[model samples]
Target: MAKIYLDPGHGGTDPGAVANGLQEKVLTLKIALKTRDILNRDYEGHSIRMSRTSDTTRSLSQRTNDANSWGADYFVSIHINAGGGTGYEDYIYNGSVSNNTITYRDKLHAEVMKQVDFRNRGKKRANFHVLRQSSMPAVLTENGFIDTTADANKLKSDAYLDRIALGHANGIAQALGLKRKSGSGGSGKQGYVEVITPSLWTYNTANWDDKAVIVNEGEVFTVARDKFKVGNGHMYQLKSGLYITASTQYVRYYTK
Candidate 1:
């Protein structure tokens, strides 16, 4: 199993950045914890570790040392931005441009921008302590500007944080080249499909009337083909065992 380290920047006494009643430490921990859940649930073999699982102060050395000593494959630092910018961005060490960290950051930045409706601040590079000290390919993400009213408004919503966490998890999954295969009962196998439309509806049966959800937008869920619905124009089963339209209007399934 590939080892992964997650660092939620600042906690307890540190508190990192704060603005508009949002503290960076709390937000980072929430995102990091959620990312761990997603990684464990979706990607099977990788082991995940967090620098601080609770609201406690942890030194930068301890964070890097733990990961280095354990031989983590990737190090991800989660934090919120300050100053004035109103969007999301990520960072790597100064000389990491030629390595896989850039690939991870690119996928991460693209995935977040695709779902969160945030302005693209672009992936960046800096001499941050976590990035420079970690032995593995490391990435530091500036989720959003806590100081910006618009960004802070989104940060205040748990729904927004869920999407942000999923986006970051998607980046980590892609960076690790993890496979999430869906077992199609009859017509071979099909992988996951991400929701792309503004809203998608789900139902209990292929032609049944009971609605499973009001609307699912910008969410990625597991899917497998229903052999019974093959004649009904290829209906797919969701993770919840509910049914939804698999058209391009709602989902996009990528190959390789």
Candidate 2:
């Protein structure tokens, strides 16, 4: 079994980044918890652990020590960015690491970019403590800029956070070759939708006016089928039972 260790950066008094009325600690924990839940519910043969599940203080060394003691196979540190920039970027240690670590990083970056509505800041390298000190392959992802209004708004959405979690979980499962629980139905080969507009409204029913949620641009979701008529054009039904416009102007459907 692969032992995965998740570290939610900054907690308690040390909120990593605070902007747009949001705390980095809270968002990181939310993503980590959701990621763990998704992995446990849909995948098998992997054991997951977190540095801090609640709002508690933890030093960088302490967190790494815990994972090292536990003999974690992989380490993923989740954090938010500040300093007036937007988009997603992840870091591996600048120093030499195993080829497995680089491969894992590539898979993670691709999966997260596929699922989240964020600009690609490119896969990067850094001398971050989490990466340098961890005994196993480690990746630290800065999801989005908390100081930027556009990115912060997405961070505030539970559904958006879930997408982030899904992306992270997807990467881990792929890197470890974790098997899908029988009938988990997340096997990407199914039809899916990728938002192309600034925002696409989903409806609980086929009616265009029956709005349910807003899926931001670049976000991807699995669809029930190819497409079906809704009004003047076509709509794609999400596996979540929500309907979205299948117009090429708003979304592009694909099967992986």
Candidate 3:
């Protein structure tokens, strides 16, 4: 099992960078949380831990020390840039690292860039504490410049943030070769669902509230649990731990 350690940059009084009414701490935490959520819900054979889950104070040393002590397999520090630049970039330790470190960074940077429509700021090497002190392969991502209006506008959107999180989650899973959890029912019967409508909204829960993400028509998702009662209707539990309506009006189910 891969042990993934996530650090949400700054927290508490040390807000890191702030601009365009966006705090680096807040955005980092948001992305990190979503990334963890996706990993836990959609993937298997991996364990995840975060440096900070809420608005609280944590020192840089404390963050690295925990990962080192735990012998984490990979460390990812999520942050927002504040410099006069824009777009996305990532960094690995400037010092010598295993070949796997560079490979992981390359895969991660590419995946993140593919998901977000931000400028490709290129991959770099830095002596960042989180990268240098971690015992395993580590990457620090500067998502976008918080001070840059164009980047800030994208950062402010919930859908955009979800994209950012999805990028990180996808990269991590790919780099580590993590296996996706089977959405098949308890009977081990595999099934799939396709969106028949022009668009469909998925929820984190079986209820109507807490919409997780939107999927376009023809998009397919694995059904973890075929169908279960939700109110007077029914919902399909996806492998990602998300729920979507089982109504034939929006989706069609297929046994695979």
Candidate 4:
């Protein structure tokens, strides 16, 4: 399992940057929390932990130490940029770093910029405390310029934040070579099964029967096993395994 560490820039007493009634610390924390949730729910099997779950204060050293102690596979620090700059930029330590770190940083930077409307500041090398001190591959992302009115307005929307979180999750998934789950049968082919309408059965055999039913016309049904037989147009299985069939009756098929 891939272990990830999320650091939301400044918090509590320290608001790293502020502009247009938006605090950098608050925005960073919000994005980080959303990103963590997305990773946990969508990225299945991976372990995700945060340096600070709420608006709690944590120093740079403390955050790095926490990540190291947790034995994180990757560390990402989320922050917003100020000082009249516009666009997104990612920073890595400016020394002899492994190629793996550079490649992962580039992937993350590209993914984030592709989703945001901000300018692409490009990947950069810097001696930031967190990046320099981290023993694992680490990156600090300046999401956007909080000082800019357009960017600030975009940041205010939850939809935009969700897209950013998705981009972050996608990048992490790509870097870790995560596999997407196949819906059912492990292939696109719809497995064979028999459908039993209410009119054909006197009682609900599914409750007591040991056979699996693959699909139902308009409702949900549990699959019992791959092998089954149809009686009165009703399919049955071993009751131990089954595939839930989705609605495809109205879908039109065409050959290319």
Per-residue lDDT, model 4, residue 150, is: 70
lDDT, candidate 3, 151-180, per-residue tens: 998898776786688789889988999887
Top-scoring candidate (lDDT): 2
* lDDT agreement of model 2 with the native: 0.88
lDDT of 2 at 67: 99
Q: Which candidate is the best by TM-score?
A: 2
Residue 111 displacement (Å), model 4:
1.4
**Stretches of candidate 1 above 4 Å error?**
96-98, 181-256
lDDT, model 1:
0.77
Candidate ranking under TM-score, highest first, comes to: 2, 3, 1, 4
Better of 3 and 4 by lDDT: 3
In candidate 4 the C-alpha lDDT for residue 24 amounts to 91
Better of 1 and 4 by lDDT: 1
Per-residue alpha-carbon lDDT of candidate 2 for residues 190-252, written as tens digits (9 for 90 to 100) = 777899889878999999788998889999988885455555556777888888886555776
lDDT of 4 by residue, 2-41 (tens): 8888899999899889889999999898898888876665
Instruction: Estimate the TM-score of every prediction.
Output: 0.71, 0.78, 0.73, 0.70
**TM-score of candidate 3 relative to the true fold:** 0.73
Deviation of model 1 at 46, angstroms = 0.5
Indicate the worst ten consecutive residues by lDDT in candidate 3: 183-192
Q: Cα deviation of 74 in candidate 2 (Å)?
A: 0.3
